[model samples]
Target: MSARTVLLPALAVLLLFALAGSLLIGPAGLSTPEALLGLFGSERGPAARVMREIRLPRSLLGAMIGASLGLAGAALQGYLRNPLAEPGLIGVSGAAALGAVLTLYTGLSAAFSLALPLGGIAGAMAAVVLVQLLAGREAGTITLILAGVAVTAFAAALTSLALNLAPSPFAALEIVFWLLGSLSDRSMEHVWLAAPFMVLGWLLLASTGRALDALTLGEEAASSLGFRLPAIRLRLVLGTAFCVGAATAVAGAIGFVGLVVPHLLRPLVGHRPGALLPASALGGAVLLLLADLVVRAIPTAQELKLGVVTALIGAPFFFALVLRTRRETA
Candidate 1:
């Protein structure tokens, strides 16, 4: 077989290795075979409880959230026809973050554990609706981006005002943590709470692959090929809000998973919009899980936030992308 045929299997093996490492090694370390057996309940021990109670859900959430963000990124990039487009960059994530922050600041999250994620969905929905009202309708990619820019600025202002007026106790640090993002201490409840919505979001985005591909040539061309722009846009907006919102609600505001994942895998998929969606989802699952693993293993007095790790990796790559895109357009 040619070298071209070898790429996928290699990536698959790498993903498997990442998954294994995530499960086996952490602050509370578990041996390889022991971890596997622990998963099924045969091996009852401290390791088992830790695996079952703590690491397992966090790992699963890492994968699920990463996949959601990656898939959301793929959808936005395809629909907007811009490689720089990502959920967070375009106001969806910011809006969700604002919603989550509101609950956190109000002390409602303390009383109602489920309030954060539900409120996040509401925030994301509001943002999507606003974007639709402001920038929807076959706008060129530049116009959509500018509209997103405007919305992002407005939302940021609103979030800042909320924070300023928040009660004295637990205000600053909570806001910082929520904005920075993390996956630590997450429980099985979070796993169950967020998974269904994330899965539904993925399904909606995944099904749009063909439509995205059709849309690459332009809405007129896609419509000629039987694609409906309004319906596709609606699905994309609602789907992204559900997935990304649940994720942000559960994990705070982990940045760049959506942006980083899709960009990282684009070359592997021959830059095809359809293939980018799933490949990005898988690649994202790997990246976020591995990052979580790294965060847990570090011996720092205070545990590293999962977002800090991913941002360190994502920021440089984002700059490179900007340079490359500018070069291409120039």
Candidate 2:
């Protein structure tokens, strides 16, 4: 059997295992069979309530959010031809967070819960447009990354400023929880709110795999091969904005899944950016589910934030990547 076939199935299985663990490994301490029964069977009580209300939504969100991040990461890395591109690095996540925070600060979220994701979507779209404008079409990879860094810093400053000047203590608290990134107390309402946007984003991104493959040959060559650069760029930008924005709206600005998952799966896909997308998505789902599970399993007064665990793991890997790239260049 080919490696791609084997690797893809293995990743899928890993994701399933992680999903099962996420459902079964919560504080309820239900066994696998009991959890499954609670999830699917007509059993009334705490097990069913926990299964339907808590674990299900959390697990679903983890998988969807991770997939969105991973897919966006692969798409960006493929199109930009850069190994270091991600939503957080490029300011998209920060902008999305700012939008969600705006809803909270303005009391829109309190009045209308759906307003939160909508605001985040708007913020993410604005960031995408801004980033594209900052990084001109002919810009080099270094130039693009620099623009991303500038935008990221600006958005982060704005977010911090919002937190500092929040209208009420509750607003500040909301911002703090969001900035840390947790899936605690999430509901099926969140699942319903974010799923449509996430699904649309996945479709748009998945459509670009062939275009990304053509892009590896350079813009001129890709154009000559009948790929419209404008359409591809729009798809990637809008798609990423929708996915990441919805993710941030529901779960806050969880970072590093996009950056780490694609990087790890790249080699396994034979370094083909096109082939790496699905692998990264599945790998990301696995990683996030596992991380969420670990956070729940740990004994602490308060659960560790999902983003904190990912950062603790991802920051070291990012540093290693930078060092390796520097060594290779040197």
Q: Which candidate is the best by TM-score?
A: 2
Model 1, span 1-330: residue lDDT tens:
754356557656766777777777876656777777787767678878888887788788888888888889988998888777887755777888888888887877888788887777778778888877887676455656776678778878888987888787468677877778888778898999898888888888888899899987888899899988778876887788789878987897777788888877787778788878877887778888888888877889888888899888889998998888899999
10 residues in a row with least lDDT, candidate 1: 2-11
The residue pairs found clashing in candidate 1 are none
The lDDT leader among the candidates is 2
lDDT of each: 0.81, 0.85
TM-scores for all candidates: the values are: 0.91, 0.92
Native-referenced Cα lDDT, model 2:
0.85
Q: Which regions of candidate 1 are displaced past 4 Å?
A: 1-12, 42-44, 136-143, 325-330
